[model samples]
Target chain A: MNNVLVFPMIVPILAAMLLLFFRSNTAVQRWGSVGAMTVVFGTSVWILQQVMLHGILRLDFGEWLPPFGITFVADSFAMLLVTVSSLVTVLCLVYAAFAKDEKRESFFMYPFALLLAAGVNGSFLTGDLFNLFVCFEVMLLASYVLMTLGGEKKQLTEGIKYILINILSSWLFLLGIAYLYGTLGTLNMAHLSVRIAEAGQPPLLTTISMLFLVVFSLKAGLVLYFWLPGSYSTLPAAISALFAALLTKVGVYALFRTFTLLFYHEPSLTHKVIGYMAAATMIGGSIGALAHRDVRKIASYNVVIAIGFILVGLASFNIEAIQGSIYYLIHDILIKGLLFLLVGTIIHLTGKTRFDQESGLIANYPLFGWLFFIMILSLGGIPPFSGFAGKLFIGEGAIGAGHYGLTAIAFLSSLFVLYSLLRVFLIMFWGESSILSKNQIPLSKGMLAPLVALGIITTGLGLGMDYLSPYVSEAAHVLMNPDVYIEGALHNE
Target chain B: METIIILLVGVLVSTATYLLLSKNLIRVVLGTAILSHAIHLLLMTMGGLKMGSVPILGDQVDTYTDALPQALILTAIVISFAVTAFFLVLVYRTYQSTGSDNLYELKGPQDE
Candidate 1:
């Protein structure tokens, strides 16, 4: 039990607290951020190992019995998410080293980044509903700071909108928790699931479930995801990418956790609702992406599309569908992180993010151009890429569940994503080298290293799906069978 | 008694939502504040309100209130306060930069 599972949550908070004391030294801040993120990565690997060995690790706080106090539980699913989030954070921090200006550096960017890490970890690990709300707040607070760090005119304006929407969501989350607490008389997720199952489909249960969906949908950038494109595009590229990659995934993760565990009985109503919403989100996001010329906005819309796919998986509620969603989530995080990093690098180099303002990057920076090509293609779900593998799995899951129509929609949405990405690639990289000069600013090795690393990781994920399949399948099993979770929560006396 | 509190909470929520949809940024912030207060009250009321004395350890404490929801509300109230304070500062900065409190005016080049 004295393993890496605990460190991912601990190291970040510790690092943030330590950072509060060192206000005078920028070098200390920089190194502290790097060191903290590295520790988190190492711990994530250790926790992954422990999950691989012990199946799942449940840690009750202070040895207190569950269904009373807060609990931090780690199954294969949560560990997988933590691993992905930590890996993405490390890469984003590396990129931020080169990309962020002095103004951004001043706002405790490193500490806030670590705080975001802690929040994601906590959200993934916590066994209590109210604890999840607190984690969401932690994440939102850090995100507000990160979004407004540079004090850019656009950042502040859009940051206000982002802040307002999220705060409202948090309030709704609290209200929902209150309602759930009133109905179930418990906040522990595992225990709540049992009570919910025994109680069957009550009106109060449905109301709370709908509330949960609304709050998480706002976070996940579902059909009502206009705020994302506007606000996400206003931040620094690294920040935007990180937010685009991980934050919404937290919402999706919550949906998966709740629907599969606590609200599993009303599949016809709840799952179907999610499925329809997912369909709308996919079509809406793809249309929005096609309308945008800015790389960041396009990426943000793509995130919405990915969220749609995840919702479909969860909505399906079948083993294959859930497993596919899980696999796609991991794939989306890595590939999307790489795409954002590449786009950030491009903007950093060319001093512009719009396709019309800049053109012909491939002729000058062949390495970056090719890497961006791979990332974009992988994002478009091309074969032999991680994105393709994820889509294939989700498609297979949909079809296996006899949802052939949903499978078709998923395939069509993939094509839409492909079209949008190809538009950017053609306009930005594959033209005559006359519209814009080669970028004069030298790319930092620290920034380039993570992008290269992510590129390899994305391909490796595609190549190594066989090794990951068993773990993902096991996660699906754990999710489908609530008995173990209920027993663990209730019998931990 | 429950109906009265629910109606009052409902009014507060509607007022807050209306204010949030207004043009002024400050009004929006105020709306959020009001809405959070309403949510806290709703949480308190949802745990099934009781006609009782303060939840304290004392003699003749026959009718004690639901301490759980109250505790949860207190925590939420503090968090909402912190977030409100943060939002105010951010709005101040935003107003200073834009030289106006109207959100519509703050729309950037992309909006045009």
Candidate 2:
């Protein structure tokens, strides 16, 4: 039985439920979540191994057959994403335990985090579009709780905007699903692909595709990425790390799926729109990054810029482009997670996030300065770090696609990211050292472990890229070809 | 019947859009609610507004309705209801912290 496919989602839901029972016990909740994520991470890695060796795997729920009942499909792409997501969740849980966001933790941060993981894993793995919507709701609901858990005046204002906008986007997503179902008579993604191909990409198809583009773009923080920095900066660090790494990436994953799997017939139209938005998001993101003085806010804009880079690769629509995007995506997530952790450390030491009054951080904590230097190099696409491979691939691929101007923007934006990060570095680490804040919380080994571990993984991805390259190539090949996903998901009983 | 529903959806969407343009927090929540309702109804109408028998697999069920859209609508409704409830709570919380529901005030510290 392929029932193993659902374990990635099930384990987390079960973990969250277990966590609810020990709501007041932070130790139990923390250990329980870490244990749960470890299991989920193991399952995801195993599922990924099986998927790679055996090709796409499918699990039909209620045995209602493929098109009629719910289905969970673990293709190479979905499994890969789930693996990273689980890894990120586990790391974030560890970071959060040491993070001391006590008020939020008391209000069940662990349970909500588990639920968020479950929702994300479900969305990535499920083969049904409607089920994807439900999973999004589950994910967003958990996010609502997590984002507003502290209930500060700052949190409430920003959280309200986050919720309202996402709610509107959710409704748009629903409308798109309705249109697709109305047109195709099925909600299964594999079935939709088949029907869309049969229908020869109608005008209605274009309309529906546009709606989906908007929905996923909003989630991915692409064209409308303005909401991202403000909201993220206002959150606690661990949650921001999780958000930066996973949440919008979910949108990007959904974008990759819908664009490649269903809406590929008119790539000239659809992919071009994607390309334009990628460009806009690129220019917009760098400008936004330069607009901020706070370290977290600046890095938050880097999140937007990285999304643009990945989207450009997707829009290029070549094997190399997809490969680069996939590779860079994993790279970007680890790097951003590390960046947030480092920023969190800075905030912990200085008791202020704004760079105006903070200076000479490295004089106090020299280790973090060097670590941030490595992260900045990695993020700036310097060689022998994780970001280099993807940027190279995408650059070459964009050149191949005759997107010369966009390629220039890509390089230009990377420089801006480099400059902005270095600006923060110069102000915080190199300037006059002030006495440590009176309320400074000492950093813990457990917390430092995740940051160091993430830093190593990110570096290893670059130095050991030969190992990751083949997998990214394979994943890109599988994703670009919809037949494999369709055949696997709709496999006969 | 179908035309009326389509027109009604149009009206609902227009009204939602209009309400959404305002800066009031409550209006924004109302806009989202109405918009979700419109989408749900649009889904129903698109699935086909047919007068038919119960959707059962009987020999007598030749003219039965499509159950899939109904199931889809139920899911959408539940999600939107959750969203709406969350929106109200958020609005209430926002109101409690700042004595006004105007989004302009929450725009920044400068506004306060």
Candidate 3:
């Protein structure tokens, strides 16, 4: 019955409505969106504090009891993501303001972005399965608009593929929910957990879980990631970064929630399948990243690789592994956002998309070069960076769980990340300048501010682990032990 | 009655699959539309067929048909409707700009 859980989802809707009135004024649109996101960020942090102090919080609509009415539960895991996503969205909005697309600005971009945020927040906080489906649609619908906002030919083609694939996956989602409801006769996640445990996860239940796996895997870009690179590479830098940072993550979050809470009885069947998919995703994404010469393609493939790495922890299914998954999830969101912003800025400056066509960016933008190098190191899991801690914990957990092959493949993929990104660095930064000064777009402070902010934040996340770990461990504790969540959600009366 | 509905759903699904595999964009869009309708029917049938009286409760009623699936299908129908509308608009715009409705022409760089 706590009230604050609604703020993260509701505030964004209110802000979107506020932004709609000022559509013609780009200044209001830009700052208003940023201001709204900042508010969400603050609200999420406060919610995190509340969860830490009071334990899990659930908001039942209209005071109806759980297992009957809709619910939004704020546990430590969801609030952590909600907070980080809101912060990253703020930075993305700051970057979008500098994008001089008049039509994009006036065409409800701010409102749609806010709606997307609202949907994402709702997905995180939702306590029921059907509510989660609705949240996914809210996010996907906004994303379709964002993807095709400009109506360019390339965007149109890729947008069609993206929308179609998502629609199909969403259909599958509905089918899964319908079957589950037919069997359990309840959509509340907590009640479903109880029922599945009582039913002992029969063969039929496991099959249904597989359907959910495929649905979420497509959304998360795990193995069914075919639509990602092309669709993502076509959008403007800011929107693309937002999609890269936030969209797949919600899918991953759903995977974490369902597998940990609803379908834990048969790890041999379900988690084993996830392990194979994670391995394949790693190998495939690495191959794609190494194969591409276009900077956007390279960056997009890097996103796939990160998705694989995070899920390896999930496949392992140990406490340390879950904690590592959480840690790595946060790191990936921040670093990927930073990585895309850097790649986009580079493409913007050189007016070229491929690495072969541009060189010696360091000679012109030393700060940008160094920041990119930091991003590379952070991404590759070097010591004293955000990526390192998560990889360490996940590796340790995988080894503890005796998943030797998965551990080896996971670490090797880090090498792939290092090699692919370093190749981009050595070639793109070290050579003689290709574009003349007269032709190059000046690197603006407005663009660089967001990157610099993300750079420091990722570093801070690494060094400030002593503070963040308590929350991460708390999240992992609830994830590892679903009883805590179930008790809180179902016994609130 | 339930078996008949399920058979109808299968027929619709086969039709959708055929249309989806075509290279024309309009057929693909229509395939998705029909596919959604098929799913909506399946969802409704999953909740039992008419078990008893109206869902509205009364002292006289001994049993009532499950109404949750009806609510779910209603929501699903509206959503699929909105998405189909948007997808149709996108296909039209793609045709207007590219001068072709063939998925072969819409293939991206990797496909080539």
Candidate 4:
């Protein structure tokens, strides 16, 4: 359990150092990135096993006692996120190896990629607020580099905006941490939870909670997500895909962590606020998606829409709602990753991103087209795909929680998402074949292989939900019953 | 002394917010820099300011300043510095490419 808990953090840092020595060799850097992600993937599997056998694995760094040192807690929830992130990253690296232009290797893309993996894993596993903030910075730094990897005019302009917004958010996050630490006097999340409970919902606590909410909302791309379409749309397809896949989920994870662990008492206010924001984010993002003609913009807006649903799940604040939220998070990460990868492949094949510029992609490239169609359908929350199952759980949870209006909103927004995706798929794949030239759609085995694998896994997720439900339920239980987290952190202190 | 520091932080925050609202990219960068510094001071102040007493434990002074917030602020200061440097570089690159420093002119595809 110790080894499994440590693997995600150790492998990436070690691989990053090795890559620094072999920086001159592009091939080594590429293979090194793949090998590192593979190890992370393997370790995630082992950690999942340990999590299944034992309830949770808590590793205190430097063997320092709780409330003083950093701790990594791996429960079913954390392990699930780590596994999904590892799978997406591994596939993205494989796809990038082929889909990327020749300039990818020269840009230190491999090292930054590993840093991103480390950041995601760190965020998922850490049991401290400040440590989570550090992880956010680590991930944001890597993302800034990745956004500007190409160094083109568009990339630089958009990348600056992205970095600026995220930097400000980090500062706000720091301020929130200071408030939390000053008021609570402990950085350990579990211990802080008990402190907050003991402190009995002071005004200052509510203010700090609101600050944390805003900071994470910016990262999660809720209503303040205007930066996303600009920044993510400007990046190369694969990088955009990866960012679209996992970055916002990290923010959602933070939202879950804070609300569940620290701010659970004020459900009427916190959950209501999140619910309202979720509805607004959904409508705005759907409209944005409908308005965009570019593939990347459409996908990016869809990410915002997905965040809305997750927020709704959180807002419900019941056992089923929390479980649904976790389940939806897992589903969204995989399906969104697949959608981005597929769109990247489409761009790679056609050299065009707008629907107006390209036509009949399906006829030109049948394999890529069909895979993209399946991913698009799944993304639209069609049946028998991962998206449908997630939406169903959240919808049911909302209904069960007696939020009938929100349930209706969720259903309507899901349709809007379906409409937007179907519009794009139809335009790109099923339209006239006359517009496309005989370019032969250069499909690389490396890129196509990962897309296919991800597509299959996303499909399998829908079918295997029965097996996955127990884990999601357990995660929800852990989050709902904060005593376990409190005990785990304060144990032997 | 703590009151003065709090007043100074308020001034810095207001000034930075004004700059952030401006149209110039350089002003926005400066605003972020100033705002982060203000936040660091605010964090330090939250730990309760003590005059002439270092946060580190020593032989003479019985009451050491609270060290936790100092450590946190120090880490934050370094992180803010790195982020500021990165933002500066990004602004420079954006200026080089777009040939202008006005953020209003750098509208994205949606603007088109």
Candidate 5:
């Protein structure tokens, strides 16, 4: 019942409300969002420390008690994501201040973005199924607003497909929940887990699990993510940076959370599906990126690549593998955020997102080119960068779990992704100067500050693994063992 | 009676799915709306169709209908309503701008 668990979520909501009130005042909204997100980052770090010091921090709304009352449970894994995504939100907001279209800014995009952050945090922390749906709705609603704020024809068209696909997926999600509740008679996640264990795995459970898989996979942009490349590519770079960093990962997080918590009974059936999907998403995402000539589209496709990689960790369902996945998830969030912001800046300056159409601004803006290079390398899982750690752990762990074929697929697909990302980087930055070679928008200090801060932190994360690994390993340990979560969630210890 | 409701739900979902798979944007919206109705019915059915006294504690009621599903369906109804509204607006905007309601004719970022 620690009050702190509620603040991380409440802070952004309050910020979003205040931001909505000040929609006309861009300066107030901008500073207000930064201040609010900074509070979020602070409190999430505080919660992470509290979770490390204490065990699980549970906030039961309305004092109704667990298995009845809605709960916000903060294990290390939840706290860690909140911490990273909060930092990312703060950075993206800074980027949004500069790069977001002035029209979009005046239209209350910032508030919806904050609301989206709130939804994401709620989804990460909730301890039940129904609440998860509600949180997804909140996130998606905000995302719908943010994506179409500009009223651009492209945004509307792609937004149509995105909304349709998600709505269908959400209906399926509700249908799954209905079935689970009817059979088990509980919507509480911990209670459901307890019930499933007592009753053993039922045949209906498999069907429900598949339904959940489809819903989460669509969000995660896994192999089923046909809507993602188009929808994400059409977005303004600032908003898409935030989307790329946080949105799909929410899906990956749900998949990890639920499959680990509830569907462990039929790992042979469930894990195999996850494993194969992971491999396919990884390979398909890479190939999709290779096929996309657009820089933003390529980055959007790489999101699928990371989704696939993280799934590989979860699919293996071993300590080391899950640990690696957690690390990779963090690395991907940071790396992807960096890519979107950096590329957004490029697009912001050049007004061209297609790789074939742009180049040689790197000749003048060496800083952007260099930072983009770091992110590109990190994204590809190159050695000693942030991405390598997760790959190493997942790869070795997959091998340890005797998933040799998946491990090979994981390694091989990454090579293709690496080649594609590098090709885009070279063509956009190294080759002939784009038409904008003569004149470039000066990089604002506000923009430069967040990028440099993020760059240093990425480097720090890569170099300071010794300090970070223990915390990551601890979070993975919590994920590996679900009984601890169930007890902490249900019993209120 | 239970079998009839389940069969009806099946029919609704199948019709909805067929509509959704069509290339017309309006049909997809229709499909989603119908699909939601089917799901709401399924939710109510899942909670059991037994008619009973209201769920009032200490009323000495012999059997009480489940209240949770009703509450959940209320929320689901509101959400679906909002979603449908948003979809319609989005559809209108897509039409006004893209000048087409055929899903394929809207815009294809998939290829070029």
Candidate 6:
């Protein structure tokens, strides 16, 4: 059992608790949390390396044996996500550090952010279903506090809706777990896999899997995204960026894990349902993105659209599509973080939220304009950017799967993504000057540094696919072949 | 015994659903709490009822009750308690800030 898998989770949690003692000291909280996250990032990278060298690594708590003990499995898929998420958290913490929002800082933002990261890491690593539930709650509770920290009227109203909806979803999740445990008599994912295969996955199991789908859909914002755009539109940029980057991705990860590993026998039922839900989400999200004049709402809808696109890869359920999903998942995390940060920065600098409220920003912030232009291209799945390869592979997979209609919708959605962002770009950044000279808030270098860093990372990700392809392929192979994960997790090849 | 608990769970769930459908904020919070209670009971009943002795080792016995569901319910209970408390506080603050507890009144964007 490798000990390294735990550090990615432990470091941030320990740092969060330590940050609590220094809550009043913003300096300590800021740099300490960043330092802690960087360490987590390093540990995650190390975990990836170890997984590559030793195949899949599993850690059973208290030395308990399989199907009886809680396990933390670090496959290539989980570690790749952990590494990227840690990197995103580090950058978000840096952004939070320099944003200079003293009110937000004073409310223990650093601790909650770290706690959220820890919860995210835990969710990725867990091999037990119950532990996954617990991790989701940990992440949700931390997010609830972060979402409503300021107690503003808008934050509270939206936050209340967010919390209630999530509570209901979590309850559904528990009920699903209860039924699964009752039927299969196991919570360990690997053992559950073996048992389901043994039982030939009866109709009752398929119905239970549907419960998980609905529960995860609410969290992932797939089709049940009614609450997403509202709550996301109200948060501060850094917090919102973190949420946009990390939260839904966790739900998506859970979907990928369960569908690929546990519920593969009923693909015609489960995957077809996912395909339809994803198509509907893309249509609904595209309409919302196209209709909104509010910049944040547009960006939030863009998030929904991306979720649909990624799940399309899952719906195809081919190796190529899964690989594309992995590549795109990593790309989306970094790009969404950058996208929200830029959108937030635009709103912050202009003190306006609507596309028409401000103009001629490029004249003042040319660098910001270029970065945003790159963001638009990257998000639009333009060639030679991070979003391109994944979209291409997913499209190819859809075609290969004989899903011509889905392939068309997937590409069409990219066009919508481009159109929506271009609308924001043309009206908000390129038009005649709207802000008075005295009113223009000079873009700070500290704030711009994180955006530039993410921009470079996303660019590097696109250009550096040669290096990432092996890991991505390995991850896809494992996901496409659950026997690999089951054997790895249970040590019973 | 299992059938009885399942029936009880169904009753609790219906009562909680009714509470949740109302417009008041406090009722919604209470609904969530009762709903969680119903789930906990369902989880417990899922493990089978009175088929065996206590989970701990004792005199020779052919079987013992599954303790895992009990542990899971305990965790769920603590989490629900925390979430209910947090929801109450949030509702109070929303009321204080917006001067309304009615869901319909709080539906639209109040500050924006």
Candidate 1 lDDT by residue in tens digits, B2-112: 889999999999999999999998999999999999999888887889868787878978887767788788889888998999999999999898798998887766543
Question: Model 6: what is its DockQ?
Answer: 0.85
Instruction: In angstroms, give how far residue A99 of model 5 lies from its true place.
Output: 2.2
In terms of DockQ, which candidate is stronger, 1 or 6? 6
- Model 4 misplaced stretches (Cα beyond 4 Å): A1-4, A435-438, B51-62, B109-111
Docking class of 5: medium
Candidate 5 per-residue lDDT, tens place, B2-88, comes to 689999999999999999999998999999999999999898888888778788876578888888888899999999999999998
Instruction: Put down candidate 1 lDDT per residue, A23-47, tens digits, no spaces.
Output: 6676788778878988888887787
Would you estimate the TM-scores of all the predictions? 0.95, 0.97, 0.98, 0.96, 0.97, 0.98
What total of clashing residue pairs does each candidate reach?
0, 0, 0, 0, 0, 0
lDDT of 2 at B28: 90
Per-residue lDDT of candidate 4, residues A95-168 (tens digit): 78876566867768888889988998999999899889888888888888898887888888888778888988
Number of the candidate with higher TM-score, 1 or 2: 2
TM-score of decoy 3: 0.98
Scanning candidate 4 chain A in windows of ten residues, the lowest lDDT window is A433-442
The TM-score obtained by model 6 is: 0.98
Q: Which candidate model has the greater lDDT, 4 or 5?
A: 5
Per-residue alpha-carbon lDDT of candidate 3 for residues B32-103, written as tens digits (9 for 90 to 100): 999999988998898989999998979999999989889989988889998999999999998999899999
Give TM-score values for chain A, per-prediction: 0.96, 0.98, 0.99, 0.97, 0.97, 0.99
Q: Global CA lDDT of candidate 5, please? A: 0.87
Q: In model 1, where do residues sit more than 4 Å from their true spots?
A: A2-5, A435-439, B50-65, B108-112
- At residue A3, give the lDDT of candidate 3: 83
Task: Provide i-RMS per model in Å.
Answer: 1.2, 1.0, 0.9, 1.2, 1.1, 0.7
> Per-residue lDDT tens digits of candidate 5, residues A1-493?
3878877778888988888888778999888998898999999988888888888888888888989888999999998998999899999998888664679889888888889999999999999899999989999999988888898878888888889888988998899999998899999988998998888878788878988998899889889988998888888767898999999989999999889889889999999999999999988887888887788888888888889889998889999999899999999888888887887777777787777787776787888788888887787788678888899999989999899999998988888778887887788888777556446677788787788878878888888888788779878887878898987899955
The 10 consecutive residues of candidate 3 chain A with the worst lDDT sum are: A433-442
Select the stronger candidate by DockQ from 3 and 6. 6
Quality of candidate 2's docking, in CAPRI categories?
Answer: medium
Q: What C-alpha lDDT do the candidate models reach, one value each?
A: 0.84, 0.88, 0.92, 0.84, 0.87, 0.92
